[model samples]
Target: MQVNATPNRRLVVGISGASGVAYGIRLLQVLRQIEVESHLVMSKSAQVTLAHESSYSVADVKALASVSYANTDIGAAISSGSFPALGMVVAPCSIRTLSEVATGVTSSLLSRAADVTLKERRRLVLMVRETPLHLGHIRSMASATEAGAIIYPPVPAFYANPQTIEEMIDHSIGRVLDLFGLETSLVRRWGT
Candidate 1:
């Protein structure tokens, strides 16, 4: 597939069924603040996670992005390697999604898009949000890394001295956005 020669200010955000749906939501909000176009795709299980984690309905969260695609939409524009995008960030990526991307056997559009990102040599950040991971999870993460996907566990930095949960979320997401060369004021630099 021929990649678009023109550079575009677009980023793909995938929210999977994990504990931290807030990360994905905050990412979209920040991307909008930075004026970068965001393409959002949420896994079906994410709806249940979202309900338990936050009051925001799925539509409310979807409205935060520039465009939204269904997980079942395999033929979506972002699923194509030729689709120009900075890369994809699977915020709160579930283990299932991680395994699929690692194996290149994507079932949903979210994982398919991630695979496309890796094939296109674009950044694919997986914000894996599980605790007490077993050997399988660790191995999957390593495999994904070997396949050119970044396994970014959203561990908070206490050095930032966050006063609120929102601050902590922003700080972590800010660092993730850095992978795409996006700088935001949400990040509190060290010794500054």
Candidate 2:
């Protein structure tokens, strides 16, 4: 499970109070398989969502990543602009978290780390999990995009012929990893 990138390349993963907690967990699993060091931070509401959606405990979730940070730990290294992370991903990004990052509000370490990623000109990918997006969401997306963040909603890809939820998760995270220039064979690409 050797990573294709530099040995110490780091990726920060944030989990918000979104429906698809599996995406964040699976992304961690895939990152471990690829030997990428992961710095994981989970919001308080994200813990509730994980309990509602899956049987895994917070300890289990934390174990998936190489390092775990408290969501309220604003002093964490990942929350600083000087942190040399290659990128950050907010998988299953809740609308609330998305709005916070879009407006540059750093109420939590997750949002602050995302803010630092953008300010540092590093990649920040938001896997927005909300549906029926309103005008506010659209505006936030636009604003984040303007700030060089990529908004990737977890929409299913029919071309991938996903037969199960795991397949769908793999496909979406694989594409997100592609944005970070990480090579993965998790999902088959179209016209491949």
Q: How many clashes show up per model?
A: 0, 0
Please, what is the TM-score per model? 0.95, 0.95
Give the Cα lDDT of each candidate. Answer: 0.92, 0.90
Instruction: Write one digit per residue (lDDT tens) for candidate 1, span 1-192.
Output: 122323457899999999999999999999888888889999999989999999999999999988899999999999998788889999999999999999999999999999999999999999998889999999999999999999999998999999999999999999998888888998899998
lDDT of 2 by residue, 139-177 (tens): 999999999899999898989899998888899999999
Question: What does the lDDT read for residue 131 in candidate 1?
Answer: 85
TM-score of 2: 0.95
Worst 10 residues of 1 by lDDT: 1-10
